[model samples]
Target: MSLTAVETLNREFLEIRCRILDLAAMLDRLERSDDTVADDPRLKRIHEAIDLLTKSASRNSSSDRAEQVQLTFSRPYDSAWLQNLKVRPR
Candidate 1:
């Protein structure tokens, strides 16, 4: 049987909150660091994923936040990738 909405929230809320706190701490560390990573693509992808998380459910019809966040960090598939990387198929 599926969990009721309240039960699901009760079970998952602390974990979710912890993750958010972790992300916030990481961002804070980055901001305080001497090195500049503001122009890095990875940082841009992180911002994109953050935006995805904050988007309203009504604005986004699909409920695949994990997939969306993952895609934000993924490169487009290239058929020649293995050849480019010089990896021989077994």
Candidate 2:
């Protein structure tokens, strides 16, 4: 991919990660509140948005890291390098 494309994707990934964190904070606040607004349809939408953002952020992070690995290991693969390719479980 072009440098511009990689830059764009990196920015998007950061934005999505930030958004997911923000949504998680908002959900925590709502869950702690005693008011009816906490149980409103808008809150449900926010919850769903959080779930979508979490998945998107995870996929983007993986893709970004994979691209970096490809760039870093452009030469013929070695056994040690292949062993290091496994992503640690989250």
Candidate 3:
């Protein structure tokens, strides 16, 4: 766990948090739109998925803090090797 790894992990976590917030805002916008609510099943499904993701993220974050667990990033460089790399706090 090097400094670089820690920085990267922090960046990734921030990015994920931002994405969750953005999805929530998007869902709010969709719900408030003037279009027929029943017209698009896809939007409904997407909203449901986003809700699930938001809940999961919230749960994970709370548990992580309680247990002092640190989130890390798995390397995406190798297509075949799935378990070779991890980035965590030093």
Q: Which of the predicted structures, 2 or 3, would earn the higher TM-score when compared with the native?
A: 3
- Candidate 1: worst 10 consecutive residues by lDDT? 54-63
- Output the lDDT of residue 52, model 2: 55
TM-score per prediction, in order, is 0.89, 0.38, 0.41
Tens digits of lDDT, candidate 3, 47-84: 55555555767776443431221221222357544345
Highest TM-score among the candidates is held by which one?
1
Q: Rank all candidate structures by their lDDT, best first, as comma-separated numbers.
A: 1, 2, 3
lDDT of model 3, residue 53: 51
Displacement of residue 5 (Cα, Å) in model 2 is 6.3
Would you list the C-alpha lDDT of every candidate in the order shown? 0.90, 0.63, 0.59
TM-score of 2: 0.38
Query: Residue 8 lDDT in model 3?
Result: 78
Per residue, candidate 1 scores C-alpha lDDT tens digits across 44-80 of: 9999889888884558666788888888888889999
How many clashes in each candidate?
A: 0, 0, 0
What candidate 2 gets wrong by more than 4 Å, as runs, is 1-7, 36-39, 48-90
